[model samples]
Target: MSHYWDNLSARTNGQHTSEEFESAAYRLVVEQVIYYADRHSRATYWLIEGFERDFREALAPLGITLDVNRQLRYVYAKPQYAKAGTASVAQTLLALVLRALYDEGARLGQFTDDGEVVCDLVELEEKYRLMTGRELPGKGEFSELMRTMKRWGIAKKSDESLVQRGDSDQTLPYAVIIRPAIADILGEMALLRLAQWKELDHMPRIEDTESEDDHEVTE
Candidate 1:
């Protein structure tokens, strides 16, 4: 991916005025940060497919490792943090999707015939657009961002043979995994927003947080 970065920058004019670039960069940052936060994680082949190999190599200084096989791709750390960082939108979306998966009790592995798996990038972004009433970063940016997540173990890809309808060339369709650590991070984010929401006049306040109560607080 490092080799392509120059071309990407040249074509996009350094992505100075591009929301797509900004979003993609944000995703990359999130993926990197989350990967460091979790010492060990792995990815499937589908998860890392769209990501650039050079990009993964750049992350090697940080103790990130990539393992690839015919049926799967894996990435993780060795109980330490890497000091490198880069800025990609694919990474951010990867984190967001993984957080959602953690909340929903799914792993960042392959989607199976008997089980639900990570959400597809297209469908996931479409949902985000619908919720926010705006278009998301382009597909290229999204792919890059997911590649970052796949590298960090925050998310993984699903095997395609389980769900694909036709005899497609692809073996696995990518999906995000929301790791336990990632879920905690996401929960913290949600908690921050919840705190912010409570500050709003329109939001319902919790009376229990204000004073002593006879019983434990309940939602």
Candidate 2:
């Protein structure tokens, strides 16, 4: 056996010979929603590309499926045994809002050739208000939510400190990069759930919503 296989075998106590690659693949998928060939570091992309088959085979045993979007140049994982409350109420709502904006942008042909939907905090807030018939969360809360979204690889902000200002001024536009990963995170079922939530007699108060920091992911 090769040195890599030998190390892997030793690590798995002879139960598996490819555990090393599998473990690495599992970590990469869980850490980020998408691994973009164009945006990710060369080494990171190469690692995923090189072990794509092993990655899928390993994850299959754990009920996690790997999805590689070649055209979009990214890879995402779908867990068969999905756990509830992986995202906070605020984060979930924000994702729905972003998904709504993305769909609207696509319908209006506003997306760039590369498939990115660029929007600002102001537009997002306006769309939220229109959709939910409620004011968007305060600057502090919205900023924190944006940080969580960015951490999860669903969105990116042009100005790191823009959200920290805590000003509700809609005129001050801060550019946000709405990544395609949003679609994967908030799939069809999630959207349906959001729609049902919106139809509730009383929507949950934004201030009372829990932060993403309080969430836990489990299989």
Each model's lDDT comes to 0.42, 0.66
Tens-place lDDT per residue, model 1, 83-201, is 33443322433355445544544534444332324565555666555433335667676566656555554555554433434566433455444334444234445423323322342
Best by TM-score: 2
Q: How would you encode candidate 2's per-residue C-alpha lDDT over 1-219 as one tens digit per residue?
A: 245545655755665555455555656656656555345434455555656775676667778888766666667777777776566656666777777777778788887655778887667778787775667789888889889878777776764424423455334547777877778877666556556545652855544567325443221
Pick out the ten consecutive residues of candidate 2 with the lowest summed lDDT.
Answer: 210-219
Model 1's alpha-carbon lDDT is 0.42
Query: What's the lDDT for residue 12 in model 1?
Result: 49
Tell me the number of clashing residue pairs for each predicted model.
23, 0
TM-score versus the correct structure, for each prediction? 0.36, 0.71
Measured by lDDT, the strongest candidate is 2
Badly placed stretches (over 4 Å) of model 1 are 1-94, 105-117, 130-132, 159-173, 190-219
